[model samples]
Target: MKKILLFALILNSTFFYAQELRLLRGAITENLIVNDTVNETYSLYLPTSFSVDRAWPLAFVMDLEGKGKAAVAMLMNAAEQEGYVLASSNNISDSLSISQNVLIANRMFNSVFNTVPTAKNRTYTIGFGGGAMFASILPTFINEIKGVISIGASIGNLEILNAKQPFQFVGIVNRSDFNFRSMYDTKQVLNKLKFPNQLLVFDADRNLPEIETVSKAFRMLTLTSMAKGYLVQNDSLIRSSYNDFFVDANANVTNQKPLLATYQMSDMEKIFYPLMKLDSLKESQKTLKRSTSFRQANRSQNSYFLKESFTKEDYSYYLEEDIISYNYANLGWWNYQMQELNKLDRSAILFEKQMSSRLRGYINALISDNIDYLAADREPDLEALNLLYMIKTITDPNEYTSYLKVISTSSKMEDYGTALFYLEELLKNGYTDTQTLYSIEHTALFRIMPEFNEVVEKYLKGARYDVIEQ
Candidate 1:
């Protein structure tokens, strides 16, 4: 039994050693003087047939800190298993300045390329989060960079990206992220540039495994597609690394690749990839049809009322369909469309009126009795107050009045400035019984009103005699 235990320990150690990453330490200099010592660390994994004489395409992964080496190692092992040499580094500073990050990235690239002479021009960089920012920016300096795969980074400057650079860029972002709007804006800019790029916006609430699997498959597809273009198709040996590199690298990889290909992805890719392509195609077709129809309708219509009504109806249907199909919770796009339609003509008030009920319903659902959930939703304070008032009038007036009184008292205790905002909302929404208003005024005097007594006194003077008596 002791011998078996000893053997088991030995076996575990052997397995660990076999998979252990190799780290190389170096330093980078921002200036010619080499004044600041940035500790540069990287890990390398070579394929089974790795040769000093033969050059291999490389992937340089930048990570946030120590984890960069491990992530790179995993990717490297996976790539190497597929007959590719991959290297990774974690030499970035937490400061996140573009200059500092770019310098560190250049230094890491130089260090790795210097050690492995064949890696000079065959490098692709990939990063997650801050690391993604590094990868996105590194190509500007490193002319040899072939491609980039960024996860959760802002690619804000589209003009800087050379459209003809042949650097296939891909980004993975969470749809529910606060940065998603920025991401979409970035994508719009990139799309205008006509650069070879792809953006995979995943559902933010999904697990990391779902994200990682999609990312891994995307990386493989991108690599394989490039490989196919280069006519290198013997990927049998590469299949072995798929499990080591991508298995549990995320979740549900099985059906994802096939789904991506159904929409023009000829290799292992994400299902969303094809869906986006199809969506884009449909949008383009709809836009053309709408423009043509609008022109034709405008030419035939004698009255402004008919033309305006027709346009608003068409836009309303389009936006409603988009919302239902995408399950978009926010009315930002609808608002924007309505605003544009309003600009085109003054008579498009119907769209705005139609959206009021839907918008109010959405706000109420968001603020529904669950305070924790309401807080989690992070509804704007003013909006919350407005909804609370609406809830008071529409659902339970007594409860709403009680809630406002409690809020007013809590605000006095906490010295919250927004109590007045809520109070104003309550007043506007007809929670204006003399007793309730007096209770609010009395609480304010002890805490908040003291700081602004003059304003409160002026407000009280304007109040009705009944309210003042209360």
Candidate 2:
């Protein structure tokens, strides 16, 4: 029995050693299989400075869209510069149930933990979009996770958080993201719960944060570790970061962005509270609050908050009603709402413009999520899919694919009238891909109808059918 156990141990060691040899440092390794039995795979990156001699801080990156390599690449530069290890599970998918994806994440975590020498109490989870929501709640389940860097998503569920098992939360969000207000509120809750947190905002239409912001997030994590005595402090880093925050706050004030300036000052207070004396910073904050610009900006923000809240509720209620009743006739109203949102874009008021963008994005996300929910069933509900596709075509007219889906689903139900209407609407939008138009599923008979070819021939120079009489 002893000899058999010894042999088994030897075999395991050899297998792990073989796996270790293949992992490369200084670059991304795309296909690292976790184990033979489970076959869980992930993309991994180690900083050029990495060595087996020292335990390294590791980040488990979640890609809600399930492209692990892309997620790894997004943060690879930051990880390399910050000297942290990164591993993202290729199986973390948006289509899968939350619990199922979490299980897949756990498998990848264990695999990386077993293979890599990780720093004790310095682990983190980071992601963008759906992955960001997943990352925010991960520390609650995986007690070892010390921090989370969530971009473009607010915390998923605040009820599950335990104050005793506190972890740092660093959120990076766009000023125009609908989740902006939610994250701001979350920061207040975190403050009351005595959880360490910071929120970084950027103004842009981009989905992913710039590389510099990502690097700052990594720096913040490292700085937090030092503050907590989890890692050794570098005084130079602390001094430089403090100065940068000060510079940013002053910049915001100069730009007449009192709200952003206050938020920046608040972040500085929380992040540096444990590391140093904040008396001077507090005095500066007080003076900033006393300024006329601050009071006016605060009042303006409060007024806009009401408008945003009312608008969001209306969207939620109307969208639910439309989806529940398959209110085809109300499609005009949805189109009208889009037009109103566009008018907000032209409004001279910046806050109104931001609210408009947020509402538009929120509605699209709502529709897509509802569509995903319906599609997740064992058998998808075609009626619901049909309604969502139609709504999507109106909300996001240029996407073009939703038009195809609407055509396919409508034709399948033999709702020739609805299908023909969208066929023309799609052409009106200038969707010139005749090849894709020709191969729409469940359209064998529908496409041959004179109406379909007529719409196509009218848009394009010629139609495949050429059935319209000269």
Top candidate when judged by lDDT against the true structure: 2
Candidate 2, residues 109-222, lDDT tens digits: the string is 887887778899999999888798999888888888999999988888899999989999999988778888888889889989989899988777665678877888888899
Best by TM-score: 2
lDDT (CA) for every model shown?
0.47, 0.85
Return the clash pairs for model 1, or none: 82-238, 209-251
In candidate 2, list every pair of residues with a backbone clash: none
Q: Evaluate model 2: give its lDDT.
A: 0.85
| Regions of model 2 farther than 4 Å from truth | 1-20, 376-381, 468-470
- RMSD for each of the candidates: 15.9, 4.4
Candidate 1 wrongly placed segments (more than 4 Å): 1-39, 47-53, 65-67, 70-84, 117-121, 154-156, 164-166, 174-185, 201-470
Candidate 2: Cα lDDT at 163: 93
